[model samples]
Target: MHLFSLTCTDFAAALHQGWGKGMFHAAAIYRHVFKQGNPDLAQVPELAQAGILTQELQSAFNVSSPAIAAMAVQEGVTKIVFSLAGGLRVEAVWIPMPRRTTLCLSSQAGCRMGCAFCRTGALGLLRNLAAEEIVGQVYAVRHGLGRAIDNIVFMGMGEPLDNFDNVAQAIRVLSDQRGLDIPHSHMTISTAGLTDGIRRLGELGWPGLNLAVSLNAADDELRSQLMPVNAIHPLAQLKQALQDYPLRKKGVFFIEYVLLKGVNDSRGHAARLACFLEGLPVRVNVIGCNPGPDCLFESPGEEHCRLFCAWLAGEGLFVRMRSSRGQDINAACGQLGGPAH
Candidate 1:
């Protein structure tokens, strides 16, 4: 059994069947592993006191984190490349803001969504990460890299909802008070408009969990051209899913709009976006495209971005222009796993 893969409750159940121990013992083990940053089962004093042999515990559970292959720092943003089994690799970013430090985690090795302007989509779908591997990123960040992360965002290599099960399991493990203890409200799962996954997530009733959609375009024809997922879950259907989503009281959806120069940055596009977001509780995050190594699109000029946000605000929509960070290190939005690899 992979120790990092199981939540505290699951671990307790496993221990109950193996050594006839109760939840207290499992909680003690979890406190050592997650809270104390010790992964060696042999080093857990609780197990030793319970008459469990070190060799026996080692034989039953596997504890490990991803190996850090490379890392780069630009300004305060740090990008970490992790080497996983089978020679596969994935990337995560550590972003430090004034209030909270955020970690952008990858749900898959590569993406299959085929977003026209995204760098990770160019690599295609490599494989979905297991629950252990998904949770291991947090372990590697906290214990391996020694960084303090207060927030988590699934906005890296792949579309998060495509790997919904593993991501959900990881969230459970990450939110355990005896473990990492990061609140569900601090975690955001961004999707490429996977309506079914959104519905399934809504069914979990984690009202504090945040949801964001990568909505570069408002119209179906243009959105379908930019993001192929739009072809599967059209704009109308996606809008309905958001409307039906059980958002926490006073919580608002985050609409990520990557402004591609001369593509989706025009005033008309802004107006269309305003119309599409009408009546929805959302905060529009406008980001200029991050043109990594050989991207076909160009980043929108500052003046253009300013005008676009102005138009949206004129329509009474809450808008914020997100500054691109880690572009120098290819760690910015839509820039992971690009030609730098």
Candidate 2:
């Protein structure tokens, strides 16, 4: 019922139905909601006088902060706690870099994927966030940052593909020019190898949106042990899905490999990963595991991480070892759903 969550087209329809106003109100409403303007119908005498702001519509349409419960800032990253209407709380992280600011959104309250190293999996599946809730996170973050975000990642506290519809709708809304005005290329959806969702996204032919697969382990057996979702959709099926996906010009898919200490950080594992991505146009991002008390997995040392990236680079693969950010605030990768502010 949140008006801030609706797409421009849908909001226009609602305006026409409620107040007899046509598409003329779409742009104004979009600006009101996304541009941080007042959305009160009482403030606009025309809509109130025309009976466009009906009691039912007024009750249903709200453009306020109902989802945010708490917020904390650490380093350059800001962590927000969003309390859904269903009584479940989820976390979102805002990461600010020198060049660009990126916000990480959660698709679900907790998670069902059960990745052994993920803290969110420890909480199990609570519920999938509605489209409005998913988009609402961005709205909340934008207000907090006092500026629009440059990038967004669906890699917060849940498996995004499991909640595909809402996530996709959120993406469309975020990329809409009338709304957040974020480009598709600036958005990324990271998944734990959900082949069905990948196929659906590819079928939609939404070019420019980035895709990142959480392929922590190149081998099926090791992957299954780390992520239970892999057992359902193995590497073979996932690889086929990636191959079938249509990529836009200069679009290179991302392979996100979390280097676990003595686990998936070996030179052999790196070689296997290079072999697995042999023919695909991909850039490998090696992240050292961000350890939390919820998971026993320890992050690989800087030397081990360097060695892994070196091995992949030796195999002629583009590799970057990304350092974990906001560790002090517990806002780094794989640290959500843990005991932190």
Candidate 3:
């Protein structure tokens, strides 16, 4: 048995004791309670295990419980929304594909970035989720899904760079070999082109960690209209920052282009994009725009999206028409902001 210092990590772990937190490590936690009473228990369950456990702690020493604890895994989709200690709600989505299950985790609650088209930033920034709050998303997902999620993407709710420290700590926790043991190679952190923040990420020396810039526009003027942060951290500086973005031993970063109709989906925009991406070995994940209350943004028609992608691909760029997932549940990219409607 090990005792962790009451560090920020420990603080986050302590908060995870209750609340909608703790996923697989809930077993490790159950293991802790077991060690207190029995001093040794089955440390871990094998990979092929399934089902659930309801640890109804005695009333005399009660901890915490949600009104309901629903546990089931289907279609390899084991998703759990962890309501944190302060009405801060973020989630981790585990989608089991034929070969792997990826976890989509949130870093903040309401985003402050105010990216006009994104739903998450609609409320304009609650507070930065703690490192624990950020990491707890994964922990709770592990508990709910009852399996090791293969991939992690920080494309959930908040603007991670704003809550920079906590997000960084949570990344450390996620990649830590001690608990979750998620390899850095399989994890990704996407930012809305925060240049200084990207520079810091490079300075941190996260080997094999993937960096994604949400560059939905090709020029600064249009980009500022979309991502206000661009007004402060211009794309020119962002490009210089990327130039310094210590690419991990031959790692390829990504530019996430959310294709908006009549916005950044034109031949001129594609050319600007190709030029913007000059002298960089990178890939672009072209995502069709998702609808929001601010319906001014339109997803490019299928033909247009394909044509733009073809043009960029012809320019010798690595491009992927990223598959849109969970739209039926309103759980697609740039979704997952408010209460389920």
Per-model clash counts, in order, read 0, 1, 5
Give candidate 3 regions above 4 Å deviation.
1-79
Pairs with backbone N, CA or C atoms under 3 Å apart (clashes), candidate 2: 19-52
> Lowest summed-lDDT stretch of 10 residues in model 2?
37-46
Q: Provide the TM-score for each candidate, comma-separated.
A: 0.98, 0.95, 0.79
Error of 1 at 314 (Å): 0.5
Kindly list the per-residue Cα lDDT of model 2 for residues 218-262, writing each as its tens digit.
999999999999999999999999998998977888999998899
On TM-score, the candidate that comes out on top is 1
Q: What is the lDDT of residue 292 in candidate 2?
A: 77
Sorted on lDDT, best first, the list reads 1, 2, 3
Per lDDT, the best of the predicted structures is: 1
The 0-to-1 C-alpha lDDT of every candidate, in the order given, reads 0.92, 0.84, 0.69
Can you write out model 1's per-residue Cα lDDT over 249-322, one digit (the tens) per residue?
99999999999999998889999999999989999999999998779999888888998999999999999999
Tens-place lDDT per residue, model 3, 1-341, is: 12211232443354367434344544444434322222122323421242223322222122222111232244445445556565566655567777777878777778888887888867788777767566555654554334667888888887777778888877776665545667888888899988878888888988688988899897999999999989999889988988888897677879999998988898898889999999877899998988865556878877888999998998888999886666544466886664443
